[model samples]
Target: MGPIATTFPVLGVAAWSSTGKTTLLVELLPRLRAAGLEVGVIKHAHHDFDIDKPGKDSYRLREAGAAPTLVASARRYALMQETPNQDEPDLVHLLSLMEPHAPDLVIVEGFKQWPIAKLVLYRDDIGDPGILACENVQAVALKGAAPDTLEASIVRLDLDNIDAIAHWILQWCAAFPDHER
Candidate 1:
């Protein structure tokens, strides 16, 4: 199948561990739903993972060296394949391969280096100084003053205020409709 064309822009959540990024996402997702926009989530894992049970048919096929395994049902399906480890897939490639079911916007987690527009999440406790390291970061959901470079472009937000954060995101999305998937 050809790549799925996006109706809205793709967005990413970039933040250090324990900085409330996931918590904020949990809240933010529902608000987006209320606004009538389709949403999808993509999470990156640094380690390998198996989504199948060890003794299941699909898992057994994979363990027995099947190159590819597909598990399907009426509601959902998954395909797993073995591939050589590459440094990392680029944003476009990853999107192409994994984004067919993506909604109006695909919300990504843990891809700070990709050039896609991003919302940087930060807190004083995590002590991560790399929140501002990427060029395409459009906003920051932060607890306090962000790095000086982000002052002008960043929208300072208290992670606890789901309403404010959602409003800010809505405004940003309105201003940049082209960014939507």
Candidate 2:
């Protein structure tokens, strides 16, 4: 595992595309927050994605060569940075960007090959090779019965049990140093 600055505890949910990663997060985030934890999220996208709409001022400003464009409003704000020719920043670099938010935990989505501890989500129909052999997989959240090949030492979780998963995440966060928490 590469050195990700341990400013905050980070737990990752890794899975192949269309394996319900985002769906699980949508359910899990609120529960984590309800438990009095401030959460930040970093998602890895396989293709170009735009949060700003065409003809929007922020989009226009970025197009006009603003390396990073910060747009703010009373309700919320966002910082969008352009990395024209640069390779995608690694997990450590991305985590550094969230330091200003000072969240208690950060849930990272995707970045399957990154060495951070992760809960590997699986479903039989995805046709992708299982990630159990991957380094740093701390647990597996399987849909339906636990696979016969699954290792007994690795924690097993039910993919459909959002409450249990959220509780497990909270417990995992507790294991991090109190200073980071």
Candidate 3:
């Protein structure tokens, strides 16, 4: 019972609320891209969010009962599906949808409780805590140093060092082969 096993390389950026998880990913993504890696991101929203506007045709069609509404343009497309029944969205299913795109790495933001191999971001000034998902946390990003009580097995990372974090992620992606599991 290690971290959640996946066929493709997946790394989760997990953190408590208001821990700047998205901000770190925003900065980390371009570095990964500059290293010539194709990356896919799946972000979980705890609050309700709306992608489509009120008067758009896609919105109208979706309101008229399209379960999965896909709008494709020449360059890009978006698929919106409504799930009112599920307690929690399935991370595996989301990963499957992105599998066909063949990204070199998939970074999952949020969904920290899903038992995936993840780097936990913690700010000592945030004051809530210094940890999340103890069993699955492979690394931890902190503003300063790791707490003395933290396990030696967990890699301590400097949150301000974007280059170092990018290097670590690249190394992680290399661990997974370019074939399916």
Best lDDT among the predictions, by candidate number: 2
**lDDT (Cα atoms) of all candidates against the true structure:** 0.73, 0.84, 0.83
Sequence-dependent TM-score of model 2: 0.92
Model 2 regions lying over 4 Å from their true place: 179-181
- lDDT value for candidate 1? 0.73
- lDDT by residue (84-180, candidate 3, tens digit) is 8888889878988987898888899988677677888888777455464355787888875556777888888989888999999888778786643
**Model 3 accuracy (lDDT, Cα):** 0.83
Ordered from best to worst lDDT, the candidate numbers read 2, 3, 1
The segments of candidate 3 whose C-alpha lies over 4 angstroms from its true place after superposition are 1-5, 130-133, 177-181
The candidate that wins on TM-score is: 2
Candidate 1 residue-wise lDDT, 61-130, digit = tens: 9989988788899999888877567665445656765556656667888877776778888776676666
User: Which scores higher on TM-score, 1 or 3?
Assistant: 3
Q: Report the number of clashing residue pairs per model.
A: 7, 0, 0
Per residue, candidate 2 scores C-alpha lDDT tens digits across 51-112 of 99989989999999997899999999988888768677577888988898889999999887
TM-score of model 1 (CA atoms): 0.83
**In terms of TM-score, which candidate is stronger, 1 or 2?**
2
